[model samples]
Target: MTTRTPDAEPLLTPAEVATMFRVDPKTVTRWAKAGKLTSIRTLGGHRRYREAEVRALLKGVPSIGGDM
Candidate 1:
């Protein structure tokens, strides 16, 4: 089996990000829209987030660009 490196950044789905922050998935979408969080869009138009960014926000640490 292929192994993932511990330092590898994992992508999180909107639902996962929402669950981590204890907010609704729609709220996560709103955050993306408001530029509070950075998002990656799937070809299908679903939003994905970086776990690192999410965790930083959770700790009340703003992103380097101040998007949070």
Candidate 2:
């Protein structure tokens, strides 16, 4: 989507995403680095993910603009 409003899409932490994928948190970070997941950075450089995208992935759907 071209316009993603912050309030409309909920955010997920790396741990939360890992839990959904049954992977480790570090693996989730690796996925982000590999461009498999779309990440939003916090001021402190922590990553956040879109809940919808995460759910889509859990259901075997590809991310909106991601590698997987």
Candidate 3:
């Protein structure tokens, strides 16, 4: 089991976020592009979203970027 620092939050894959929002993974990607959600790029170039932000969005909270 790997340990993470307090500031190191777990990231969510686009597919994971999609499942929570009942949307397609592609839609999640689009949302990132549109700034509806904030995404972090891995060294491999894949996008990862902050889990807390995604959950907040699911709760009908405004996104940090306020684009949603």
Candidate 4:
């Protein structure tokens, strides 16, 4: 018999997602509520984002090549 451990998935907290997009945490929450981004709630009611989804959004965005 072979035993295997499933790989853990990467999940990003609202704070981390905010930092990635340079937005406020509340903005992330709003996006979640607006269905702009997919999010899962923790047992304690905190929102978490999937890295893959974030990456997809980032890819669609055009680079400005400078600080906003």
Candidate 5:
């Protein structure tokens, strides 16, 4: 089994993640609800995402027919 990296930071807020992906905050929330992205909840019920996971998702998205 693979071990996790100790140097890795925790999670990012929805707003920060939205800025990273260039999408609206609600989009991040939708992704979490649909299981496309993973998030954790705070005691106040706020959502947060793992940056490494988000980066992996970004890599899988195909560019627009070479236009991107």
Candidate 6:
């Protein structure tokens, strides 16, 4: 099946991702560092995750780039 990519995906904070994964916020940061999750940096140096990617992980689906 072909999947369509959204032009503008919603970004999520570490805490928000943590809640979705039922993990600690620090664990979320570690996942970013280890490349388990992809993170985007803000101008203020905060990390943001793509909501679609995170949801895909929760559902055990591979992301677009197939990192997982």
> TM-scores, in order shown?
0.79, 0.79, 0.85, 0.75, 0.71, 0.80
Candidate ranking under lDDT, highest first, comes to 3, 6, 1, 2, 5, 4
Residue 25 of model 4, lDDT score: 92
lDDT (Cα, tens digit) per residue for candidate 5, span 19-59: 98899999889888877787898778999888877776678
Can you give the lDDT of residue 16 in candidate 4? 93
lDDT of 6 at 9: 78
Which ten-residue region of model 5 has the weakest summed lDDT? 59-68
The clash count of every prediction, one per candidate, is 0, 0, 0, 0, 0, 0
For TM-score, candidate 5 versus 6, the one ahead is 6
Most accurate candidate by lDDT? 3
Better of 1 and 4 by lDDT: 1
Score each candidate by Cα lDDT. Answer: 0.87, 0.85, 0.91, 0.77, 0.77, 0.87
Residue 6's lDDT in candidate 5: 97
Tens-place lDDT per residue, model 2, 1-68, is: 34667777788999999998888999999988888888999778999998987888888886655555
- Cα-lDDT of candidate 5: 0.77
Per residue, candidate 6 scores C-alpha lDDT tens digits across 1-68 of 53548876788999999999898999999988888899999878999999988998999997644553
Which regions in candidate 2 have their CA more than 4 angstroms from the true location? 1-6, 64-68
- Please give the ranking of all candidate structures by TM-score, highest first, separated by commas: 3, 6, 1, 2, 4, 5
Per-residue error (Å), model 6, residue 39: 0.1
Best by TM-score: 3
Candidate 3 accuracy as TM-score: 0.85
| Model 3 per-residue lDDT at 66 | 80
